[model samples]
Target chain A: MSIPVLTPNIAAALAADVYDTIEMPAGAEFTPATGVLKTFFDFSRQGGAIHGRSGGLLFRRDSGFAVIGKGKSLTPYANSIAIAFRGTQTGYDWLSNTNTRTVTIENQTQAHKGFYELFKSMRPAMEQQLNPLLRNNAHAIVHCAGHSLGGALAQLAAIWIKKFYGNKVALYTFGAPRVGLKNFALQAPGSVDATYRCIHGDDPVPLAPVWPYYHAPYNGQVVRLTADTGIRVSSHKMRKVPHCYQNSARGDWANLISRERLQRQVFLKREDHHKVTFSEYWMNQIWDALTTLLRQSGGASAFVFGLQGLGAGVHSFYDNLAIELEKSGMNQQHSVHLEGLLACMLAFAGKRVIRAIELTARFIRWVFRQVLSVLDRAVRQAIQQVK
Target chain B: MWHLQRSTLVCILVGLLALFTHNPAEAGMFGWFKRIDVQVSPEIKGAITLHDKPQADMVIKRGTFFEDSWSWDSTRTDADGHFYFAEKTVKAREVLHERQVAVRLLALDYPTKGDEDLFFRLSSSHNLKSRSSDLLTDGMHCELSAEYTMSYLKSLEYPNMDWHGFQSKCRFLHADKVIVSQAELDAAELEETWRGIHSLLAYITQNASEMDTDDFIRFHVRSSAESGLAMLHKIRELETDIDKLNTLPNFEKKFQHYLNKLNKEDQR
Candidate 1:
C-alpha cells in the first residue's frame, strides 16, 4: 500500500511537538503525540553528550533532539517515518543562531556557520537511528518537520536523507530562518520531493541572516498567513501569542494565500534611501539592491569571490561592494543610492549623516561595520524570545 | 652635624605619616577619601487576590537586587489578603547603585501550574531620580485573573533605548486611567477580523454552493459574491478604527459601491 500523504496543518502540529521532546527528561521514551504512532528511535540517551553548559548569568540548557517514529492510523501514513527537530532552547543555541558566518558545503553551496554546527552535532545520532529504519523499509517515505531554528535543521536533514538513504523525503518548516546561500537554496527542488514553507508576514525569523542567505524552495511560493504590515519579534513565536505561526497555520492549505510570484520592490531613490526605516519591505529592497550591484560588478562569481581565501570575510565582501558602487560611473543612480544606503545605516546607528556630498568608499565600509554590530546586538536580544 | 640630624629626623617623620594614611581604594596617591555607601529600595504596600476574592496567608516572595546578587524575603498575606514590606536597604563600600526589585505571590502547586497562575508579580526600580513614579510604593491591587500588562522603560540619560519587557499584573490605585496604545488596539482588531474572515470563507464554501449534474459551475460566482459581502461587513465593523487615519483607504465605501454594481449586473 502507498504511504499516506501529509498536509500543512498536520506538519505544523508535528513540528510544535518537537519542542516537547526537547524538554522531555533524559532516558524517557518518545510518546506518541500528534502524528507519531510508535516510537522507532528516541535519541534521548545521547541528550547528555549534545547538551551544552550554561554560560554566565544566562542559565541556559543548550540541547537539540530529533525523534523518529511510525505514524498512527488516524494521523495516516502507517508506512511512513516521522522525524522532527526542536528549535533553539538555550543561550548557547541563541549564540549559535546569531553567528551568521558562512561555511562552504558540498557542490560549492554555503550555509550559516552556526546552523551547520548544530546540524553536525545531531547528524551522527540521527544517522545512527535513521539508517536502519530507512534501509529496512525501502518504500517508506520520510517526513521531516520543524519550527524556528529547528526548521533550518529540518531543511538540512531533508537534503541529507534524500542523498544518503535515497528515500522519498517531504520537508516542512514554519517560521524558519534562511538555512543557506543561493546555491544551497537552489538544491531544494532537486533533493526534497515536496516542500511546505509556512510563514507569517510579520515573522522576523524568515526574514534573516539577511542578503546572501536564502530560504529553500528558492524563489518558490510560501504559505503566508496573518498580513501584519511590518516585521515583529512577537510574530516569530509558535504558540500563546497573536499572529503566531501555530495559530496562523490552521485550516486547509488550499484556502490559504500562496503567491507564486512575490511582490517586486521599486528602484531605490537616493533621496529616499536614507529615509528607509527598519522594516521587512525596506530591508528586502536594500538587500536586493546590494545583490544587483554585486552581480553587475563581476557576475555571480562576485558573491563567492571575497567569501573565501585568507583574510576574507563578510566585512571584506561589503568593502568590495562599497568599492564597486563607488567606481560604477556607468550608472550614477546606483552609486548615489549606495551612498544613501550608507547614510541610512549611519542613521540607524544614531549617527545620521544625511549630506548629499559623495562619501569615500572606505567611509561607507566603516558605516556598514557599525550598523552590523548594532544589528548583531539587537538579534542577540531578540533571540531570547521566540526568534 | 646638628642641623643635618634635625633635617633627617623631620624627613623620617613625614614618611611615617604618609605610610599610615595610604589608601589603595583611592585613584592616586593624593586622591580623595572614599566612603561606605547605602542604597534603599522603594517601600511596598500591595494586596493579592485569586479569582476576584482575597487570598489570605499566601506566601509573597520579594527579591531585592544588591549588586550582582538578590536578597530574597518571604511573608504571608494578612486575613484581608494585604501584604506590606518596608523599604529595604543594602550597604556597600565605595559606592552603591540602585537596582530592580521584584515581588511574586506563589500559588500552591496542584499537578500542573505555571507563572500565569500566580496571584501577583510586579517588578520596579527603586531609583526615583530616574523615574518619577514607583509601582510598588503606590496603592497596588493585584488580581490573579488579570492578564500581564507590559511597559517599556525609557531613560533620558540613555537615549535610543527601546526595551519593552517589563510586566506587571497589579493595578496602581494612585496611577491615572490606563491608556491603550494604537498598536495594541489594531492588533486586537486585526485578529478578530482575520478570525471572522476564516469562518466566512468556510461558510461560503459549505453553505452557498449547489452541486449540478456535472460539477458546481456557479460555485465561483456565488463564492465571489459571498466573499464581497463578507468584506463589506468586516470593513463596516472596523470602519471606526481607521476614521482618524486619512492615509488608510476607505475600503468600506469602496466595497459598498462594488456590491451595488454587482447587483445591477445581475439584473441586466
Candidate 2:
C-alpha cells in the first residue's frame, strides 16, 4: 500500500513534540499534568541527549508528547500520542547512535547496529517515563519523530512500541541518516507504517551512513520543507543561539492559520511552482568561487575537498543568517510559498558559508596560540646558530 | 616536520573543519515535484551478464525519493540480450516528485532459481530539467556489480492478477473510461462541495458490495462529474484491493484520458 504524505502542517505539529523535549533543560521534571509545551490533562517531559547516554528528553502532554520549542498549533496529530527526538547535542553527540554502514546487523535477524544501540540507550528512559504513558493511552497511535540521529532512534523506538504494545506506530524523521540496511528498512516488522522523513533544502544529515546504507528502506515517505531558515531545519544542531534567534524551527513550520479551520476551505488548491531566486544564483556563484579556491593544486585543497565531501552537497555551510533574516523580517512567510521557498533555500545556503567561516576563524585562533611558543624557540635556536 | 604543501595544508584545514561540525538536529523538509525523461542505453552493445552468461532481461522499478517503490517502466533484452528503453515519466505524476529508480537484473532461468531478482539501486538518477517538458533526459547508467546481493520477485503479484504493470495497462485498454484517485470527498469541506462528495461517497459505499469489478470499472469511471467518485465506487462495490487500482491495462493512455476528462469537466 502507498504511504500517505505528511503535510507540512502535520510535520510542524510533530516537530513541536520533539522540540519540546530537546529544548527542555536536562533537569526539568515532566508530568501530563504539567507538560513542558502543551497543557493537557496528562502532560510531562523526560529524557536528555547526555554525552555518554543514549537517551534524549521527550515531552508528553496527555496522549501527545512534546518538548520546548515555538509551537503554536496542535490539532493535526491530536489523537496520536507522540515522542520527538533530538539529532545530536554538544559533547555527547557520539552517544545518540552511530551507523556502522555495513548494511548488516549484529544479530542478523534483528535490526541494524545503530538502531539497536540507540534503542538500548533509550529503552530504559522510555520504559520508565513513556511506557506507562503508552499503557494508559493504548488506544492512541504511537508517533515517533526526530531530526538526524534522533530520527534513527525514532525508527527503532517505533518498531519496539509496535512490537510491545501491538499499537499502530507512525514515524516522521527529518534529515535523518540511514539507520540500517535496505532489507532492515524493507522487512522490519513495522517499517511499513505511516513514517515520513522530511528534508529541507540540501540539509546533509539525510545523506549519511553513505553508499549501500539507504535512508528510505522502511519506505517511509519523504516530505520537503522548502521554507528557509524562516523555517527551522537546522535549529536542532544550529550553534548560534547566543546570537538571539527567536521563533524556533517548530514555530517556523507551524501554520499561523490552523489546519482544521483551513480544512473547511480549499487546502491544497495551489501546488505552486518553485522559482529560482537571486539568492539561489548567488549561492552557485559563491560555490564556484569556493570550489576554485579549493581546486588549486595543493594537499590542503584535497583535504578541504575531502572534508567538504563529508557533508557539503551544495548548501552545506554554517552561519547565523537565519538570525539576520529573522531580525530583518525577510524570513517570515507563515505559510509555504513558491517565492518564499526559493528565498529560504538561498538564505540557507548563504548561512552555511557563514557558519564555515565562523568555525574556521575559531580554529585559526587556537592553532596560532598553540604554535606561538614553538615558533619562538625555533627562532632563538636559529639565531644562536648564526652567531 | 609539517609537509606544508598547499594541498597538504588544505587537507589539514579540512580535517580541522570536521572538529567544529555540529549536527543540524532540528531539520526542515520538503516534497519536490519532478518530471524526468529516463533513458537507458548500455555502455557497450551487450546486455548485462552474470557468471559470464548474458542475462536475459531487466526490469526497471521507479520509486520516489522516499516512499513506496512502483514500477514506472520496464524493458526486456532482444535475442542478442541487448535492449534499450527511454520514457518520459508521468508515472505518479499526480503525486510529488524527488524520485529514484531501481534496475532489476531479470534472469530468465528455468523455474526462476533460488536468488530471485537482483536489484542494483541507482540513487538520485533522474534530475528533471523542466516541469513543462517530461522529456528531460536523465542519463542513468546501471552498472551491474557483484556487490548487490539482495533478491526480490521480478514483478509485484496479486492473488488474481497479472504483473502490476500489465494488469494496470490492460484494464486501461479494456475500460471505456478510467478514474484516478485525486478528488477527495473528505477535502470537500464546503457545504455544497462537502454534501456532493459525502452523498457520492455514501451512495457508493452503501451499494458497493453488490457491484462487479469489471462492470464497475467500465461503467462508473465515466461518471458525469468526472471525479474519482466512480473509481471509489468501483473499490467499494468490488471490494478491490487499493494496490490493484492503478495496475490497469494501458495505464498511460487511460491516464491521459482521465486527465482529459478532468480537464474537460473543469472547462465546463
Candidate 3:
C-alpha cells in the first residue's frame, strides 16, 4: 500500500476519512484505501450473538495498516480485511471506558497495565487479521489513525501492528486523548518517527479523565489547528479541516466529519422511541434475556458454534448456569453458598428443567447477591491489599 | 373575629412556620422521596489471565452489558494476579430502569500451561427482584484464531449442525463438539470461495451505478487515498439493503433470500 510521507495534511485527511467512515453505518461495504478497504461483510453478525467486535471493524484505517490475508481456507475477499474501529458515541460506554483506570494488555502484567478498553479490544483483531496479511504480503504496511475516540483506537491499533505484526506501520491520531500509561509511549508499537498526532484548537476532549490517565509522550509530529479553523474533539461535522500550520495538507478535516457522512448514525438513532412496535420491543427484550443468560452460563458457550434466536433458548439457559459454577472462581465462602443454592436448584431441575430456567435466572442472581453481601467486606479488604 | 385572641393567631402562625421549615438534620425533610444509592453486587468477576511461567497477569472487564451494547469498566490484576472491579453503588432510579449488567471476558493471550483462556460471562444487579436483563450468549471469544475462524465460516457454509445437540452440549448435557468434520471444513472453504465470488458480483452491482470503469476501479482500489465518498455510498446502499432484511432469528433466511434474488437477476 502506498502512503504519502507523514505530512500534516496527509495525517488530517486520513483522520478525516476515518471520521467519515465512523459517520457511516457499520458493516457498510466500503473500500477505504485504493488497495485496502476498512470494512467487511460478516454473515455471522446477521443472526449470531452480537460479538460486539463486528461494528468497530468498519471505517478509515491507518493507510498501509490494511490486513490482506488468504488463509489456508480459500475465500480471498473474506480473508482480506483492514482492522478499523468505530468510535463509540459519548455515552455510558465512553464514560465507563475512559474511567476504567487501567487494564493489563497481552504479555504485560503487574506494573505494565495499559489504560482503556476500546483500545485494548482493538488488539486481537489486529493480530489475527494483520498477522496473516503481513505473512502473505511482503510489501504490506499498516497505517493506523482515527478521530476522537477513534484516534485513541488507532494509537493502540498501530501499537499492536508494530509489536506483533512487524515494523511496517504509520500512525496518525486526530483529536485523540492520551491513551494508556505514560510508559506505553516508551515502548509502543511503531516509532514516533512514523507517527503523527493532531488536535484541533480548544478541543476539550483531549483534556479528559484528568490525572491518573496519562498520555505517553507524543514523540512524532504534533500539530494544533489554527484559531481560524478551530474544532472540538467530538466534532463530526463535515467541514474543511484546516491545518494549524501554513504548510499542512490542502484538504479540510471537515470533509471526514461532513453532514452527509453523519447519515451513517441512522442505526444509532435514539429518536425511534415513537416508532417501535410492541412485539418488536418485546422480542428485543427476550433476545437480550437469552443472550445474557448464555454469557453467564459457561466457558463452553464461548467455543460453541452458532445457534441463533428462537432456537436455543432453553438449552442456552442451562448451559450458562452449569458453566458458571464449574469454571468460575466462586471465591471460598461464595462457592459454598452457591453450591448449596445450586444443589437445591439442581433438585428442582431434576423434577423439571423448565422449573430450573426460572430459578437459574432470578433465583441464582438473588442467591449470588446474598452471598456477595456477606463476602463484600472481605473481598474489599483483600482487594485493598493488592491496591 | 376581633374578640378572638391575637395571641392565638400569633401562636398558630409560628407553628406553621416551624412545620414548613423542617429541621435539616431530620433526613433533610424531603429526603425520603429521594432515591438512595443501592449497592450492586457482581454475579461474575470474569478475568482474562495472562501467563508467562513466572507470574500470571489477569485482565478483567467491568461493564453493564446490554442487549446491543456494553458500558465498560476495565481493570488489571495486581502483581499477585488478583483482579476485581470495585462494586458500584448505583442510584435506585438507575436500577429501576434496568435489570442486570454483564461482565464477559476472553484472554488476551494465556501463555501459562493449564491456564487456557476460558470464555466467561457474568452479571451484576442492584434490584435483583425485578429480574431485568438483555444479553445474548454469542461472541465470547468467537473470532479466536485461524482454525476457529475457519471452523466458524464453514459452519455457516454447510449449515447443518445438530442444534439440539449443540444446545445440549452448551447446557453441559453432552461432550464437547470440538471435532469438526474435514468434509464439512472443505465444503465450507468452497462455500467461502463461492461467497467471495458473490461479493465480487455484489461489488460490481453496487459500483455499476457510477457508469464508468475508472471510477469503479478507483472505488474498489483499497489504497488510492482520494476521499472515496462515491465508493462509500455505493457500498452502504447495497449492505444496508441486505441488513434491512437481516434479523436475529432469520439472518440466514434473509441473506439467502437476497442471494436468491440476486442470482435470479443475473439469470435474467
**Fraction of native Cα-Cα interface contacts (under 8 Å, chains A and B) also present in model 1:** 0.00
Misplaced by over 4 Å in model 3 are: A1-13, A18-28, A32-83, A90-98, A106-116, A120-124, A136-138, A189-193, A218-220, A228-387, B1-268
lDDT of 3 by residue, A242-304 (tens): 222212333333332211111011111122222322121222332233334334444423533
Worst 10 residues of 3 chain B by lDDT: B163-172
Order of models, best TM-score first: 1, 2, 3
iRMSD of all candidate structures: 17.7, 25.5, 19.9
Off by over 4 Å in 1: A1-4, A25-27, A32-64, A73-75, A92-98, A106-108, A260-266, A298-313, A327-333, A344-353, A374-378, A385-387, B1-268
Tell me the whole-model lDDT of each prediction, alpha carbons only: 0.54, 0.35, 0.35
DockQ scores of all models, one per candidate: 0.02, 0.01, 0.02
Structural similarity to truth (TM-score) of each candidate = 0.54, 0.33, 0.31
Q: Per-residue lDDT tens digits of candidate 2, residues A31-103?
A: 2111122321123333432111442244211111233211112222233455656544322222112223132
Best by the lDDT measure:
1
Output candidate 1 Cα RMSD.
16.0
Better of 1 and 3 by lDDT: 1
In the range A1-387, model 1's lDDT, one tens digit per residue, is 112235555576567655544433433444423211221222333222222223234453444356666643211243467787766644433333234667765435777666666677677767766777788566667899888777887888888888888877888888888877677777778878878788877665676665566787788768787777465555665532334465577666667647644435334555664566556666666666555555555533344445542123455656666665555543566566666566656655445475664656777677767655544433433444222
